[model samples]
Target: MAPRSPPKRVSISHSFTSFFLGFLIPCINAAPLGPESDRVIKLPNQPATPSISQFSGYVTVNEEHGRALFYWFFEAQSEASKKPLLLWLNGGPGCSSIAYGAASELGPLRVGENGVDLHFNEFAWNQEANLLFVESPVGVGFSYTNTTSDLTKLDDAFVAEDVYMFLVEWLQRFPHFKTRDFFISGESYAGHYVPQLAELVYDRNNDTTRYPFINLKGFMVGNPVTDDNYDYTGIMDYAWSHSVISDEFYHNIKQVCDFKELYWSTECNALVNQVFDIYSEIDIYNIYDPKCLINTTSSATANKIKIDGFKRVTILAGGYDPCYSPYSEMYFNRPDVQTSIHADSRGEKWVSCKDSILNSYNFSVFSVLPVYEKLIKEKLKIWMYSGDMDGRVPIIGSRYCVEALGLPVKSPWRSWFHNKQVGGRIVEYEGLTLVTVRGAGHLVPLNKPSEALALIHSFLSDEPLPNHR
Candidate 1:
């Protein structure tokens, strides 16, 4: 491993727009330059507004399917030390990380009014780490899932291979970050992505021949669906706990909802869907649903606000439904989330959540849970968090899995307090940390940005989260 070096600072010649705005203090600049003479430096909240001059060429993962995977990168303004690199993967076998990571999370910009520029996310994750967002497989987001069967039969291993190939070439293209500490982070289905890929990295690391190891430090997942059984069970509990449903409904679902059908047979899967639909329609729990339903028309502005509010609430609830996007929609309607990479005439709406991605392959046969177990046994660090309110895969399910791991409990479960009420709860056992964001649904970052950021910081630093009690 290379020696770790702290970032350096430098003066910027550019005029400032605000007290917060200044050129990246030269520390984050990827441009070739000398380390500054100063030992101490403060990292800016946002890099000075990036000029067109700073935009690097796009990293294209050209495959045979005629669809190309595109990735754009930003380097520190100065190259004083090797910074940790983080690769962000968006869930949805078909969603683009560019939409999630660039538009929403770590990017310096957001999409506004028909793909127009908007305010920067001062808390973007990239500021603290080198970030890479990938659009994977073939038909996902911009990535073209190759053979028709590959598209329909996508599995964890196939994604691991495509991503591995992309990284090998990506390193060849930008050798600078090859040795930098690498970590994988994602949400939703990416719960399966980071671990499978990390296992591949570990395998390559152990093998002296055939493959070379990629320097990977660890990985993180927010509102992940780690196990299918646990996810479904957790959702019901979340619905019940949050009054999305009734305890009776949860008990009834647990009793009558057949897992054998959902996991084993096609007929069973259909039955499970029927159950979810029946439960979703009228608050099976017999409780009033807090979520407000809105149908906006004509004005995109109205739609954006409504959708943003929905996402914010979902994230805060830790329960996710983005609620409006059709489960079958192929492309997101928002221009900012659109992909010039795979914009086809088919005109399908991009889906935020999908059963197709999960059902595409026989998860019953080749689930990545084994891979995560292997990684855990190897003592590789892993962190998993979830939004408490997410119905698809609630934080309760995450807790269930941790309990299944049977790792020695390191910290007693306690409420994570924030905003006058319980923000969520957390427990650390062995080296693993499991967190639930109060009021946050599936997409925690979109909901509780501060808590999510703070969690990521602590995870990245390998430290215990602060006790709010």
Candidate 2:
């Protein structure tokens, strides 16, 4: 494979520095002193009033290669000092948590229409925890590496290591959060990221002699990419069950495709491509939801972007505006916005998802079931959730992944409620919990913010989802 090309390098203009300092100093003094340099006083188009304390800046994960990861940390909306810390990551093997997690989904501010302003997200997850969003690896979002070779070598292990290092150094910058209960959460490709990073943190926590301890309590993922065999099988089954494809199409795929193998045969790929062709017509991320019609890259283009044999659709936030990804790109790439967030975009413009990173990422791991087995034994809280309407990493696949574990049922599946209405369903296994968000697509928080908030509250508190309406 050819080495991945690096983003262009750009020098910051001298005039921007003057504007940055002039705009930054007043807000800096208003916030508390810890990691003050990274404190974001205000965003360019944020509401005139202040809400929560936010810090955004770079944390170097590798000094040798000049690689650094960018992070935006939001203190809990209230009683921040007493709340646990939650780290959110978005999966593309190459997407930015800043774009999906912070800008659109659970962050305190949602980028407004046309990417010209920001509005408060009432259901922001920080209301329950100190939310931290990172732009990971060496080439996603504002994160970058001076070593061009780093982009080509991207893989699960590489990402986990860099993220782990980021956490360690990030904690050093704000030691108060080091001992706070920490949890990792994300959706989609994050299925791979959240678990792998949890395992690394779990293993490293045991050997504090060489690493700084992270108080990792548990993790949760939504519509995660788990075992390849189960996920692929689930994809076809889901498409058929949901009536996304005809019975004949489904039958042909099952007959020609052997999902158990690491690589699909040409016949299977061809069959799958046919499915993608149909999926392109609808929002594959959320089958029932409308596609972002105005966006240049349609769902067809998104379905073609894959890592290894796994399909990775373009990261989109589902809600009032279907084109949330483009808005994020427009908002974050603004020079003033970058200056406010201390983001140096190198020469390349910020994008919600980077195709180059997805294309180059080495998909070496076939299954994370082994990691799941190990972590379950360690008594860490593990929860898997799915937005039932999501066709990409459907609840069907998540169900199969959970069943494969063969854990005894602690609690039978039952409907869970929020706001006097059915929120979703939940089932508890001996070591894990599986949840489904009703009327939601791939990005649950974006689609059903209230219910997603309720779900997280239940997860973090280790309490049952409300059985009564």
In order, what lDDT does every prediction score?
0.56, 0.83
The true-versus-predicted C-alpha distance at residue 142 of model 2, in Å, is 0.6
TM-score of 2: 0.89
lDDT, candidate 2, 55-94, per-residue tens:
9999987787999999999999888889999999999878
Residue pairs whose backbone atoms clash in candidate 2: none
lDDT of 1 by residue, 236-279 (tens): 66666766556666676676655424334545444446546755
| Count of clashing pairs, candidate 2 | 0
lDDT of 2: 0.83
Off by over 4 Å in 2: 1-33, 296-319
Superposition TM-score, candidate 1 onto the true structure: 0.72
